[model samples]
Target chain A: MSDYILHCFAQSGNAYKAALMLELSGADWKPEWVDFFNGATRQEGFREGVNEMGEIPVLVHGDLRLSQSGVILDYLVETLGTFGWETEAERREILRWILFDNHKLTGYTATLRFLRFIAKTGETDVVKWLETRATAAYAILNKHLDGREFVVGNKPTIADLSLCGYLYWPDEIGIDLSPYTNITRWLETLKALPGWQHPYDLMPGHPLPCA
Target chain B: MSDYILHCFAQSGNAYKAALMLELSGADWKPEWVDFFNGATRQEGFREGVNEMGEIPVLVHGDLRLSQSGVILDYLVETLGTFGWETEAERREILRWILFDNHKLTGYTATLRFLRFIAKTGETDVVKWLETRATAAYAILNKHLDGREFVVGNKPTIADLSLCGYLYWPDEIGIDLSPYTNITRWLETLKALPGWQHPYDLMPGHPLPCA
Candidate 1:
């Protein structure tokens, strides 16, 4: 029984990110599932258990509680000394793209996908809205991926892992992917990773992999 | 001159969070203003400069290029030894609140505020939506600030700086703060820091103290 415990929803992309990182780092930890659908996250006990704002993918190392997938990933990378992603300059580039995934790509596309698929209620214009944002996101990714195999540099990093969780979901939401050849090829390379298969196989109703 | 260079918008709260951290670290740096409103950020030259996605608050230290306010804040805190905000156990708690601010507080409030003020486009039951989300965001803050001066523990940390940027904008967006006395009091306390007034005095009409 490892002393580290990860509290997160099993199917959440965010949760999977942390789980993947933990596996990649070979850290001993227990994965405790937090039920998102049941509003278990909103409970007072859970909130206090982790922090004031009860969000998931919270890693507890005995008494210390860490939140935010990015923060947790960085903590693991630093503690484990697994800087295989990039060199000093490239690490910063990785950060920039990871932030981009959070602030722009995942921000809009995830919301639109959630509203359309999960919520099953919203304006009909949401489809168009998602397409526009998804296209724009892919354009950015496509340009960056033009001559590279990974996001920041030659190796798969936490940045690639973070973006892959979202980028792999376009077809499920009826978004097209035929145009981004580089991004598609990169996804193939990422999926070739040993732990990558677990998330794809585990995600419910997993969409067909990128073209 | 110190080796750090921060590229950010002059009046952005997001940018200010990074700036405040740099100043607190007492690191010598220069600010390169990116005119976001005019799409100066979209230029290939500027995009390639710091972030391919072209967002601000991109910190360049030596050869390191970092983005995302939360990550940058953590890097600063870790590198500068300025861990004044919370105790060791509470550091992750502070991070939780910071993530919550990004994921929940700013998440809803930005949409509501944008629909109401900037877009002037979501008039259909917009006020109701704004009120609901604003009340929820404030209630969370109010609960967190109940008896504490700072967000996490007694001392102010990057967490407070991150959340303060969002809460300070209520007046501009017509949010009623009279109900959240604890937040208001905390805001007043935070605003009293030396150079705290710089963000406000420098960027008039900007909502955050450091904006």
Candidate 2:
């Protein structure tokens, strides 16, 4: 039996945030596919049993069940003893980036991708608005990465993992990543990390039945 | 001089999250108003000097300056030594709710309110989409607060402060809070805390010049 059971599906970048971390850190973990597209998360049973928030990437470790990818990543940092900060200031810096990722980066990019690629909503007003917001978030991150190899320090941390979650699918998201030179450079840096894997390759349920 | 300086504006719930924490915890903090309405945060100087992310609620203490409300709240937990968890488990729980607030609740609600009330976009497609997302987030939080007075533990914590940052302006957000009985009750419980103040009352830049 795996030590950490991550409730995830390849379609979910948020879930990828956790799956990538567990795999890269070489944690004893397995993916429990979630049928998010078919409304698995909206079901009452999943809500009550797995997570009250009805979100994915729920990590079940023995008696401990954790939800929220940021929380899961932070927990893994303590348990796996990898990709974590040594100083309090560095820890806070990593956290600052993680919070930005959740609130601004992933928050906009995920919805934009769902509409543009998955749901196929086309360029509706909502999609356009989300694109604008997502692009703005990208600008901030790209500017921040101007001279830095990693998000917080010279080493990779969970902050990089969190921000890069939804960024892997630039084509699916319909965002031109070529212009974001700094972001592209940073993503390549992360890709070179020893155990890094693409979201689709890292988790199950990829190539949705229709695809 | 106040030991803590918070760069904020009256209309920003993100800023209020930090301001309320400082006030409720009886921290020696003062608000340094930012002209967000007049595009202060968009200026190159503000982005470079204040926050590279181009946001507000930057908490300055001595030489350290911090942005992102979640980061600020967590930092306050350590410095103020109040509204913090006693155990690692409890800490993770608080972090879970804070992540939910940032990614789901505030992410949608803030945008919805900005369009509906501040920008007055007038029921546009984007506004409608944001409302749907924001309402869904509200339902989840409302349900979570059903049997609990606070977000994480029995006592109030930064989790509650983080989640309730923007709920006070239901009318402005155009979401009637009457239906969410649990959330309303929880808000009241928080209001009954020793030192509680509305965002407008607590931060500067209220009553815009036009108003």
Residue B52 lDDT in model 2?
A: 92
Per-residue CA lDDT of model 2 for B1-211, tens digit only, reads 9999999999999999999999999999899999998999999999989999999989999999999999999999999999999899999999998989998999999989998888888999999898899999999999988898888879999999999999999999999999999999999999999889999999988887874
lDDT of 1 by residue, B76-107 (tens): 77777663454544765666666666655665
Give candidate 2 misplaced runs (Cα > 4 Å). none
Question: C-alpha displacement of A131 in model 1, angstroms?
Answer: 5.5
Error of 1 at A18 (Å): 1.5
lDDT of 1: 0.68
- For each candidate in the order shown, give its overall lDDT on alpha carbons: 0.68, 0.93
Error of 1 at A102 (Å): 3.0
Tens digits of per-residue lDDT, candidate 2, A1-211, equal 9999999999899999899899889999999999998999999999999998999989999999999999999999999999999999999999999999999999999999999899998899999999999999999999999999999989999999999999989989999999999999999999998888999999999899975
- Please list the Cα RMSD from the true structure of every candidate, rounded to 1 decimal place: 4.9, 0.9
True contacts kept of each: 0.24, 1.00
Error of 1 at B84 (Å): 5.9
lDDT of 1 at A76: 73
Q: Cα lDDT for residue B73, model 1?
A: 80
